[model samples]
Each structure stands twice: as structure tokens, then as C-alpha cells.
Target chain A: MCDLVVTENGSVVGTEKGRIYVKLHDEELTTFPSESLESITLMSNSTVTTYLIKQCLTKNIPILYITQNGKYLGGYRGVTTNKTSLQRAQCELFNTEFSLNFAKKIVTSKIKNQISLLYRHKSCDDVSTDIESMNNLKKRILFCDSIDAVRGYEGRAAAVYFKGLSRLSGEFAFDCRSRRPPLDPFNSMLCFGYSILYNLFYSLIETKGLNPFFGFCHADGDGHASLASDLMEEWRPLIVDSSVLSLIRKKMILKEQFTKAEDGGVYLNKDAIKTFRAYIQNKLFQKNHTVESVEEKKSYFDFISHQVSTLIRAILQKDFSLFE
Target chain B: MCDLVVTENGSVVGTEKGRIYVKLHDEELTTFPSESLESITLMSNSTVTTYLIKQCLTKNIPILYITQNGKYLGGYRGVTTNKTSLQRAQCELFNTEFSLNFAKKIVTSKIKNQISLLYRHKSCDDVSTDIESMNNLKKRILFCDSIDAVRGYEGRAAAVYFKGLSRLSGEFAFDCRSRRPPLDPFNSMLCFGYSILYNLFYSLIETKGLNPFFGFCHADGDGHASLASDLMEEWRPLIVDSSVLSLIRKKMILKEQFTKAEDGGVYLNKDAIKTFRAYIQNKLFQKNHTVESVEEKKSYFDFISHQVSTLIRAILQKDFSLFE
Candidate 1:
């Protein structure tokens, strides 16, 4: 059984054993018998004596020390000369691969589609405005932009993109609403697309050996890092945004297939969702060849991220690219 | 034995019969006589025709419609309807209570002390810089004094706050490296503080009727609503932030107790975390009486979000508050 231990101050200590201790000023506290304590997070500030340290070392307990603000201080093992190299190596592999995959997906095809989808709904006049804002956003990110500028414009850009994407998707699914209605195609597509992106990012992040909580782009907190969101940004247009457009334009699915509910909301019918899933799977794994002679087959997602990483590496190395 | 229908597309379809004919574009799609169809999604679009619909309705076979994008179209036998209502009701109740609780926490606390704790750090100047950024961030949030401002800044402001928070947190955690030999007392305090806030927010959000995704301040997407992050913001100063300041100012958790890891990281032993967790719990749940006779007995977290929401509601209603 998975046992979750939520301490008094909201520090959740999950372990197989249900036992936990509350330490006082200088005492070693345990609420239960000396059972196996699999995972213990020290969110307390009691004085650490050598005896207490030795006891933990003898017990071989893995302890995570975190600040009150949720900053991970580090983990404690009884042994001083632990194999840190293995941990670092594992983390490096995970981070590098994850970053590479993310970049491959973003630079080539995904970013273009995401940007296009975001701008798809804007009036002809507003297209430039959207483009301009995006360009500015890109510039800020590329220049290792001022922490201030990056911080300042991030939320606004996110809002514009989110609202724009939602509106465009809604429009694409409008015709299908009254006639076929089962679920809101737009919302479903968004959710499905996000889910896929999230799973991919989550897997990659987990593989990297880094605590997802310790992230660069997003904040650190209970809900921050949002590795899924960070990775999804580049792919949103290509996968979700384009998928919606294709479904609408192809007329493979019709509006009559959707159904409206009592809640004044819409959903897709079961058949429709099945069809959509097939389409997306095909899209993700679709092969593409960049050069005529190379004869290389790569997922559109993979190709895009690879390009993005190259661009990112260039930017980091101070070699300028159009991505900036 | 429960047998699932296997389809070419890898979706599972269930049927009472041993086998069923699935309409496909090319050949008459047929499957072996099995307990059920493993992949029901591969069933041709024609399977959902009027005759099939009527038959399904009469037989009470659970029918689910999905879009090509894997959006849940409605399902038959009232499963979708019931589930949707239950989910919605749950969301609404959780949102209201969470909001009320959070708001109450902020109004009754020592505001400056709370803010300082969230922003303070002892290990590096980078942490201090992060703390300083909070003042500007607060100003940015407060400057959006009206609903219009809130809406205008909603996207960018939230993003900036998230970014600032992440950066600040990263710095305080010493760039995700191990802490130094002389463990930063402020670091442990903040970490413990954050854990508490995270747990509190997690609980409140669980109770709220809102889909943590459908957040007002943050945009919507896989990572956007980050309800946990949103909730943590309000109590950053008082719980985690303030605890750090107090710990350092009073030297509750000493620097010597923090040991260096083989990886050159710093961390407090388990004893420290336990001690701090208790201290935080006491402070958060501490009750005080005010002359106004309003029950000031709410948890610190409850007070934080309440104040933030009150500010938001006042802004929405166009009533001015000092937070501006």
C-alpha cells in the first residue's frame, strides 16, 4: 500500500511505512516503532547532533532537506564519500537528451505551426500585431534577454498565445457543434494535445535524473516547472493547433457529430475522438526528409526540436541565428 | 472472462459476443471469435449509424463517441453526464472554500515579516536579488489595481511573477547545487516554509470546485493554471518567506548543522527539518484575537489567499484597497 504522510506544516512525507516523527528543540522524535522509514524529508530546523546523525546513518535513511520556501537543500546519506559521479552522470544524460528532444521538436516544424495557429484567428490587420509580439518575445528569449524583460513580457505573451489559440480552435470546431456535437472539439483537441505533450516531457524529464521541481524556465514551488508546459510551448501549433485545422478543413468529421450538454458546454462523440487520436498518432510519427540525398526519416516532432536545439546551442554559444 | 476487442488502431472495444465485424475502408474487417473487441476505436464510422445507434441504445451497450483528437464525445447509458456533473460540483465547492480560506490568511498576519521570509536568503547575493525583485513584482501586481488592469496584466503579470518566483527560488537553492559547508540557515527555513505552503495549497485546491486548470490569474493550458503555484504565491511571504527571516534573525537553525555532500551540495540533517516543520505548523495555526471581533483563528494560508482575493474582488467591483 502506498502510504502518504502529511506532516503538520504541510510537508508531505510519503512512505511505505505510515510512521513519522515530529522533532522538538533537541530531541529525536518518532510517532511509531522503529519500522523502515523509506523516505523522510526534513522540513524542520532542530539542532543536528553527531549522535542523531550517526543514528540516521546506521538506519540508512534517505533524507531530503528542503527550505521552508520549498527549495531543495540536498539529500543526506550516512556515508560522506558517496558516489556523486553516478548521480551527476545520470542527470547529465537525462537533461541533454530531454533538451535535445525538445529542441528538435520546436525549431523545424512545431514552432512554425504553433506560431501560425496562434496567428490564424487574428484579423488580417492584427496578424502583424501578433507576429510583432511573437517576434519581440523571440528576441527577448534569444538575447539571453534581460531577466526583467523576460520576466515582464512572459505572462502577456503567454496570455496572447493562449487566448489566440483557444479562439482559433473554437472557430475551427464551430460548424461541428450544432450538428454532430458530443464534446467541444476545440477543448478536446487542446486537452488531448496537451496530455500527449505532457507525457512526453514528463518521461523525458524523469529520464534526465533531475528533479522536475528544479527547473530553469518556470518557477519552483508546488506547481511550478510545469515541464509539460515548458516543452509544449514549441509543439502546440504543430500538433494541437494544426490537428484542429486539419480536422476542420478535411471535413473528415462533421459538426452534427457533436452533442451539447445541459451544462451549456459541448463535447465530441466517442467515434470522433477515436478518429482524432488516430490522426494525431499518424502526425507525430510521420516521416520527413530534409535533404534529397540524405534519405532520412524522422518524426515531424523530432525534426522540429532538433532544429530548435541547434538554434538554442548557437544562441548560448553567442552564434546568432534567425530564431532570435 | 472479460475480453477486449483488438482493433488495427490499437483501441479496445468491448462486446458480449465472441467477435464482431468492424467496418473498414478496404476489406470487410473481421476479428476472431473473442470475448470482446480489444480496440473498439478501429470500428468504422459506419458502425455508429442509425441502426447501430438504435441497437446499442436498446441493448444498453455502453457506447462512447470520441473525436479524431481523442476528445471524449458523450457516452451512452448516462456515464458521461453523471461524471461531468459530479466533477463540476466538486470543482465549484473546492474553489469557493479554497479562495475564502486563502484570503483570510493574508489579512490578519504581519505582512512585512511574511514577505521578508519569502524573499530572504543567506547563502548568496543572488537570493537577495530574487528577494528584491519581489518588491517590483508586488508593485506590478498591485499596479493592476482595476479589473481592466488585472485582465491586461493577467497574462503577462502572472507569467512575470512565476518567472521571478522561479528565479528567486533557484538562486536561494544555490542554483540547484549543493549548499556550502556552513549551511545557510535562511535556506533551510525557506525550504521548510515552502513545503508547508505547498501542502496547504494542495489541500485547499483539492476542496475547491474549480478545475485547478481554470484559473483566473494564470492562462489555461497543460502548465498554465498551475493551481498549486497560484495558491502558493499568496502565502510565500508569511509562511516560507517569513520563517527564513525569523530563523536567521534569531539563529534558530544553526549553520554548523548543515553538512557538505560529496557532490558539493549543502543540506540540513533530518533533525533540522523535523524541528522546523513543528515551528511552522505552530505559527501557521496560531490564533490571535483582534478588537474587531472577527474570528482571527484561520490558518496562515487561509488568511493569505483571502486577502489576495479580497483585493481581486474589490478590483473587480472597482472598490479601492490599500494593496494598490
Candidate 2:
């Protein structure tokens, strides 16, 4: 009930005998026993079955499917045990005036994180223009009228911040935000990191019986992943961006490790992918103090789940201030 | 369990008292007691809530969500009351040689029906070429090396058949099989009909504890709806295509009852959508003979559920010929 049993790297398979078996080609490697295993993240080309998957599903143990290069493809889980109280509150407050206000809170928090990041890097000589632009956007969100306006300010702030990121010197040069086959080495790393963050938020949101497409900050639509997208907004700069920028600044991702496609799309070569995966995995184990409740150090994994609980509490109480 | 308790064409609200209160803009119109309701299909903008939805989920009573325009959006259901015998068999049989045989069976049946439809319309004298094309495709499927090849034949056959359908009548024209904002009225009707059929299959598959995405004909990718799509193939001509063609032939859908968009796409006008919904609902209640078990007459709704049970039986026996 407390911890995830992560089995990453190499091919893994499932069994009829209620255990997870890992392998490298034809060689049997290890088995994960089914006990106190809250979830399993498959980071390799793994084989599994409906029977074992159902066994995990019924117990509400999520099976997260990730690519070898650490892109989150999808997740599987059971019908959540009903928390009628929070579910009712979520349905009631959703798409109302209260939901709109909560969305504002989320965007405000996101802009705050962006401004804080700039404030931290302000001492750098060439960052004044970027910091000033972000600061202006943050101030505008205070008088924002619509969800579109909030999103407008957030978008503007990202443009300013990424400009600053590109100005950083090293192998991890930031370009424009390009995905759907990331066009550069830095963007490829950022995309993978954001996928993991989004998937983490998805698991957390659904455990509380909140519909992932129903959200305060995102437009409701089929297949939107709105709630997870909403929850990861503030954390994007704090977690994914910081990690990405650090990797670039430290020369962890090298130019030679990127491949150029005929169509001009750039991808992380295999060795580069291996290095990036290791860095992300290491980040999962690293602890940091929460910006809001600053005391004990907490892993990124723990902090994300706690964020979902805070969201649930916010929906139920009609107060979103806990989000900051 | 034999009959659905439907409350349609009104503004309805859910209550904690285990009954649905029908309302029309703040005026309480009627109420329906929740007993003997096998499922609830919301066919309007009518609102319902967590309390009654939770009540239905716990009892394994599925709640089908449909838009006013008769698009089947999604469904909510409980953890299936597991039949471990069938569940275990389904997993074991999936993706095996026997499952491949089942995929072959589905394609064979689908192609056969396409040929039959062409034959039935042979009085027109111009459909001979389409019939010959479909017959060749059907033969090619018998020698298909992979599921992709089988799917390739299926795709080709649809192209030939839709070409035939477009040639039937001037007003009942079809250009291509356009879904995702179906660009013509015929396509709009076809897409709506297909959605209903797919949703029906989804409910049946889940009731047998077989995962909808795990199937013989599918790649088993995330969110494929493979089983639903798989099961509905054999019935498409017998159901949706037949109903759509009949509506056009009967002049039930008029050309004036369609709208032209700025992008030159055609959509069913509101009144036309209402008419289409009625025809689909009526078809659901119309009795039809089963292709395999030809004894008792059954409604389309009953037949779809029976097909799932037959699939469960096939998985257990490892004899996919029953799928025929």
C-alpha cells in the first residue's frame, strides 16, 4: 500500500502464477512477487497478459507502460474504490464559477513558479530581459478575466522563459518547444520528462475517482487528459524544466548523441536515451522540500501524489488556496 | 435484466432517493423508479450525478453516455463479477494460433456479408464489378499471412463496397468512409450508427471479464477498443449499414435536413438527427435471427450480448469456429 515496485530496463513478462518475471531475450532474470506492490512501471518492451493485468486491476495496482527511451505510453488500473464524497463534490463544482476560480489559482501558481525560477537566475548578467517579461505576465494574471486570458499569460511567460533557457551555454541548448517527434536533443529530453510528469499526475488524479478529462484549468473534451494536464502545470517548471536545464548546463546531453532525421527532426540516439533514462530514474529518488509546506525533504514521486490529495481537498472545500 | 428502463427526450436529474426525476427547465415533469433497469442510457443533455451513478456501478449496471445527436461517447461500469473460468481461458487463448483463427473467422464473416449486400442490390445491374472485387478480397483473406494482411483486405473491401453504396442513389451519396466530423450526411448517419453498435459490444465484452483491448485481430495497443470493433464487424452490414441504406431509400432522411458548413462538410440538421435516433432505437428493439444459432429470434440488443457469451465459450473451448 505504501511503495511502488519499479522494474525498469530489459524485457519483462507476466505469469499465470501471479508473479512478474523479467528477462533479457531468452534468459530469465528476476520475478516480482505480488504483495504490497502498489504499482509496476514497465520501461522496456515487456510482455504481459489479461489475467495478470486483471489481477493487478482488481487490486487497483496501476501498470504504467513506458517506452525504452522513457516516454509514457499509457497506464492500466482498476475501477477505483469509490469515495462518494469527493466524487460528488467534483461533479458539483466542475465547470461552475468555483471551477473557474480554481483554474485561476492553478494558472497563478504556474506563473509564480516561472517568476520564482527567473528570480533564482536573476544574478546572471544576460537574463534581465527574460526575467522582466515573465514578471509582467505574472502581474497581468492578477487581473485576468477568462480562462483564455490566464492561458495567454502562461503561454507568454513560457516564451520568455524558454528564450532565457536557450541563452544558457552547453550541449543542452534550448530551441523552440518542438514535440510530436521532438526536433532537437534538448526538446527530446524535455518531452520525455514531461510525459513522465503527466503520467504521474494521471495516476494520482484517478485514484481519488476524479475524471482526468474533467478539470478546472483545461477545456473539457474527449481524450484531453485535462486534470493531469491541470495538476502538472505548476510542477512543470519546478520539476521537469529545472531537471532539463540542469542536464543541459552540466553537459550531460551531448550534441553527438543526437540523430538528425531526413525530415529535420532530431532524436536522442540509443546511448543518449540510456543516459537520459538513468538521470530521470535518479531524480525520482532525490528528495526536495515542498514550496508550500517546506519542512522535510520529499521525493518527486511522493510530492506529486500529495498534490492530487490537495486537489481533492480543494474541490471538496470550494477553496483552492491550498494549491499554492 | 431483459428490458432497459429508458427515460428519454427530457431534462432529467438524479436524486439520492434511488429514482430519476425528469425536469424541463426547473419544472419537475416525472420520475422513474430505479428497479428492473438493466442499464441507463442518457440520450440527452440531461444531468445525473455521483450518488446514483455510484449506486449503478456497485451493482454492475452500466451507464451509457450518448450525446443529443446520438453519438455514443463512453460508458461507466463496475468491476465485472468475475467468471474466473472464462477470464482465465480468455487470457490463455488470446494472441495464440486459435485467436488468429478467430480473427480469420471475423474477416471471413465480414467479407461474406459485404458480398451478400452487393448481391441483394444486384437488380441495379451496375453493382457486378463491386461484387467481383469483394469476392476476390474474400479469397485473398484465406491466404493472408498476418493480421495486417487480413486488415488490408478488410480495408480494400470497404473501399469497393462504399464505392458501390455511393452509386446507389443520387441523394444517398457517399464519397469515402469519413469519420471524425463525417463530411457528408450519409457518413454522419453511418458514424452515429457505428458508435451505438460499438458501445453495445463494449458492455457485452466487459460483462464476460474479457478486456476489450485484448483481441486476435488487434495490435492490443492503448485505447484501441479492439474487441468492440472486432465484435461489431460481423454485425455492421446486418445492422448499421442496412439501417442507414433503408433510411435513405425510404426518404426518411431528406437532403434539406442536412447543413452545409463553410468548409463544405455536410452535417445532419437537428431534426434529421432526431429522426436518425428514432430509427436506431427502433432497430435496437427489432428481432433478428442469429447467423450461427438459428433457433430463437432475438432483438439486436439481445443478440450482441449473446455474441459475447459465445465468445466466452469459444475462448474456453479453444475452438474459434463458433465465432462464425
Candidate 3:
């Protein structure tokens, strides 16, 4: 019921007598009962046996891959989630007014989460203008006639929000949000954590029997998990951004642990990657009270799962109200 | 340039200093240069490192997994082949008159291949009646207006084809074509070889950026690579059946190498699996003169790749004439 993160470069993973075991340089590092594993994340250059692949597929545990710099490199899927009806419904929803509305709801919630994070750090940094801008942008989403307009507002709000976060970074300089190869440590950690969160959302969406390529918010395109990307948008500030900010404020991941490439792209080293992965896993599994259900504390995993379930229901019933 | 078949149980595969290495129980068994690998196939309980997976992905080498009994469990894909226009065209061709015509061509070609195989073994077995029936079925396919009718004719043709194959089996028992758990040794080898061939087609179909699920010849369903199945139909007799027949006739795989389960299902054991895998690999890569271009020799792999490319052209142009 937990994520097994294997970050060692030369480690080999395989199953032995129904138990999953990890080895590094021929020495057995550890073994876990298959039941204890919810999913597995392999970072850098670790190896896995076909036996482990088979066991993961049989147990429905996804095996995700991340590059050394923390870019999500997809994963080995078991039997594809194959609900034709759900996919049909999802495809039908695309390019409709309902899709536009759904996109607006997602964008607004994302902005709201960004505003909430900014307000929480208001005492430490003057984020009043960013918060106000985000709030106004959230309202403007209601008037968005197209997905492009919603995307435009979301992009503008992200710019204002990231600028506020830069002020909150203190010692860690974050001039602007940079991806591919993050320009700064903060951006590096943010991109890394976002990649993890994106994969998490991707797995959950596929598990819910929804086509990951079709989406209401993100436009359908080749080679992109549009639906998963769409779902991750709302949770970016709530999960990844929050986890990254906590790591920076707690000094858990130092800037020295990150190395700059010749092209000036920052990347977390092996040990720092381990720390970041552990922190993200803890953040995902930790339970916290929500604004709507203050009496019931829910883990980030539970919240994301609930959102996916609600999205499926919305698609099936042609009703976005319950999801919103 | 050839497939790296990893059949050793407990063997760990990884890359060390840019060379792909296999270690068993920490003993260095062998290594290969990345450029020397075309694809990878893992059988039984072998292990592979994430580094190898990354290497394979980066090199665009596909890793296929097959169970001990030779059932294809699937493989780890790198970046998905993403030509949106190709996929769109493929989906649009489904359930159309073109689809029906295209399906007829596939079925006819399949039946013709069956007849050709029967004729090749005519001197050894009395397959005249079966060959005649297949010819009639192939002709019937041309008049068929529906895919189901084409499938019906195809099934009947396969029934006749397998019967003739059984007559040609000599010492091996092949009462009928039994799958899931093949009922006899010949059926076991046939199924195993077909599984490999099916996966080969599946990978090629995806690499061409055509939707493997939306197939003109086969009805789409849950968890099935219908397009792969559709394309594999024509190649079954040409590749798998031909290989299995040669193996049986040549005694390349002995009958004792097969084992029967408690429920009376037959499967190839570990050693026989190696022999079968090697034979199939040889058969796929072996170049020989073909009927269409008798002066020029083409490998089976070339034939399959050409078929896939032709299929793409057919879909794009909305024309099946060139493909047929």
C-alpha cells in the first residue's frame, strides 16, 4: 500500500518466491512482500527483471520510470483499462460546451489553490497582488467561451503565481518558471515533483477506465496523455507546488545537492533525488483536512482518486455539477 | 541486428559502461553493444535493469515478454508512436465499405497462404480436399459484403487448414487447433509461435503510428490489439504455421520437450522454448525468394514491414487496391 522508490543507478529488481527483491552490485539490498507494494518508481539507471514486471502486472502495481533529472519517462502498464463506454463518453464530451465548462472549472480550481498557497505565505512575502490577480483570473474563467481563453487566463495566473513563489523562495532564486531543464533549483524541484504528480494522476485516470489521451481541458494530441495532463492541472498547486515549497522552506533539499549542466540547467543529484522522492511520497500519503470536508481528513491520494471518480461520473451522466 | 532473447531464469540484464551486460547470480554471463541489438525478448523469469530499459527506449529497441509457456504477456514501450493524422485515418476506415473490402482481402490472403502451405506439403499428406475448401473460402471472401461474413469464412477456412495440418503432423498429435492451453504438442508450438508473431505485428503496427485497436478486419473489443490481430491473420500461415511445420517435420523440437498440465493442456518446456524461439527468430530473419517477386529474396520481417507500410498507405489514400 505504498510506493517503492528505487533510485540506485546500478540496482537490479526482481521477484523471488513471490516476494519483490532489490539488488545492487550483486548484494541483496532488500525485499518486500508483493502485497505491500502499491506502485514502484524506478529512477535513473536501475534495472528490473521480467519476473518483477510480470509480478507487477499480476498484482496491478504500476512500474513508473523517471530520468535522473526527474522527468517522467512513462511506465509499464498491465492490461489496459478498457471501458469502451466510458471512453466513448469521454470522446463525445470533447469540443462541446460541456467541455468548455469543465475546462473552466479545472482552471478556476487551480487558480484558487494557487491563491490559497499565496495567502498562507502572505506574512512571509507580499503576495497580495498575486493573490488578487489569481482570484480575478479565477472569476474570468466563468466568462471563457473557449478552452483557449481558459488556457490564456491559466497561463497568466501561473506567471503571477510563480513570481509570488519566487519572493517566498528566500535564498533559493526563482526568477521565473523554467522547464525541460529547469534554470534554477526551485524550478528543478518543482518540475521534478510535477512530473511525479503527473504520472500519479496518469495512472489513476487510466485505472478509472478513462482514455488518457482524450481530454476536456487539454487538446487531443499525439504522444501526450492529454486527459491525465488535464486532471493534473487542478492538483498541481495542491500537491506538487505545496510539496516543493515545504521542501524548500524546511531546508530538506539544499541548493548544493543540485548540479548545473553546461547549458545552465539545474538537476538534482542522486541523493537529493532520493530525498525529494521520499518527501513527495509522504506528502501524497499524508492526510489533511479539506476546506469542503473539514471534519474528514483525506490524503492527497484520496482527493485525487475522488476527483477522478467524480470526473468519470460527470462524463457518464453528462453532469459536471457533481464534479465541480 | 538481431533480437536479444533472455531466457535464463534469475539472470539480470543491465548496461555497464555503455555495453548491455547479463549477469546470473552476480556472475557476468555476457554483454552486447547497444548497436548490435534490434529488439529484446524476455522469456520465463529473467530480469532486466532499468538502465537496459532506458537504453532500449533510447535506441528504439522494443522489449517483449513471453511467459514460460510461450504466451506473450506484452512489453514495455518507450515513447508512443504518435501520428495523429494516421490514427484518425485508421479510425475513420473502421466499419466502412472500405473496411469490408479490406477485411475480405486479408481473409483471402490468409486462406491463400493456407492453401499454399497445404500444397507445399501435398506430397506428404492427402490435403487436396482441404486445399479445395480453402480455395472456395477465399473465393467466397470476395463476394462477402460484411466483416462478420468474412470472419465466418475465415474461421471455416482455418478449420479446414488445421485439419490438413494435422494430417501433415506425422508423429505429433494435432487433432484440432486448441488455444489458451493448446491441447497437443503441435498446437502448443503453433500457439507459441503465433504469440511471438502476433507481438511482432503489434509492435510494427504501433511503430507505423496506426491505431492498433481500431482495425478494419477485426472487431474492436476490450484489452485486445485488434489491428495487430487483423494484420497477423495473413502472416499466421506464412510465418508461424510454416515455422511450426518445419520444426515438426525436421524434428527440431522433439515431442518429449513438451509437457502436459493437470487439466490436459500442453506447453513447451524451458529448453524446447529456447529451440522454438531460436527457430522463429531464424525464420523471421531468413531471406528467401517470394512468390510475388521470385527473382528477389525478401526476409519474413521485410514482408511484414512492407505489409504494415502498405496498410498505412491504404488507409491514408482510402484505397485498398495497392495493398491487396
Q: How many residue pairs clash in each candidate?
A: 119, 0, 8
Worst 10 residues of 3 chain A by lDDT: A79-88
Candidate with the greatest DockQ versus the true structure: 3
lDDT winner between 1 and 3, please give it: 3
lDDT of 1 by residue, B1-324 (tens): 111222233222322353554444545455455433212221112333223322333333434332221222223221111122222222232224333333333222223343354345434234454445444544554433333343443334334333443344432433221122323434445554564454344334333322233333333233222455555655565566556545545666666656655655455655565556557766665664242557455655446546444534433343334322
CAPRI class assigned to model 1? incorrect
Cα lDDT tens digits, model 3, B41-107, are 7775777766677766655577777677766666666556656556656666668888888888788
The native-contact fractions of the candidates, in order shown, are 0.00, 0.00, 0.40
Model 2 Cα lDDT, one tens digit per residue, A1-324: 323323444353455365556566767776656674566666543444434454565566666655544555445544334353454456556556776677677777887786676667666537877777787887888787777888888888888788777666354666688987788887877887788777777766766666555567786543446678888888877777777766666777778887877777677777766666567756765775556657778787677776787777777787767643
Name the top TM-score candidate: 3
* lDDT per residue (tens digit) for residues B244-297 in model 2: 878888888887888876766667777787677678767886776455646767
Instruction: Determine the backbone clash count of candidate 3.
Output: 8
Compared with the true structure, all predictions reach lDDT values of 0.42, 0.67, 0.79
Cα displacement (angstroms), candidate 3, residue A254, comes to 4.0
Q: Scored by Cα lDDT, where does model 3 land?
A: 0.79
Candidate 1 scores an iRMS of: 26.5
Model 3 stretches with alpha carbons more than 4 Å out: A12-32, A80-93, A290-296, A314-324, B15-32, B80-85, B290-296, B316-324
TM-score of chain A of each: 0.49, 0.83, 0.92
> What shift in Å separates residue A317 of candidate 2 from its native position after superposition?
41
TM-score of chain B of 2: 0.84
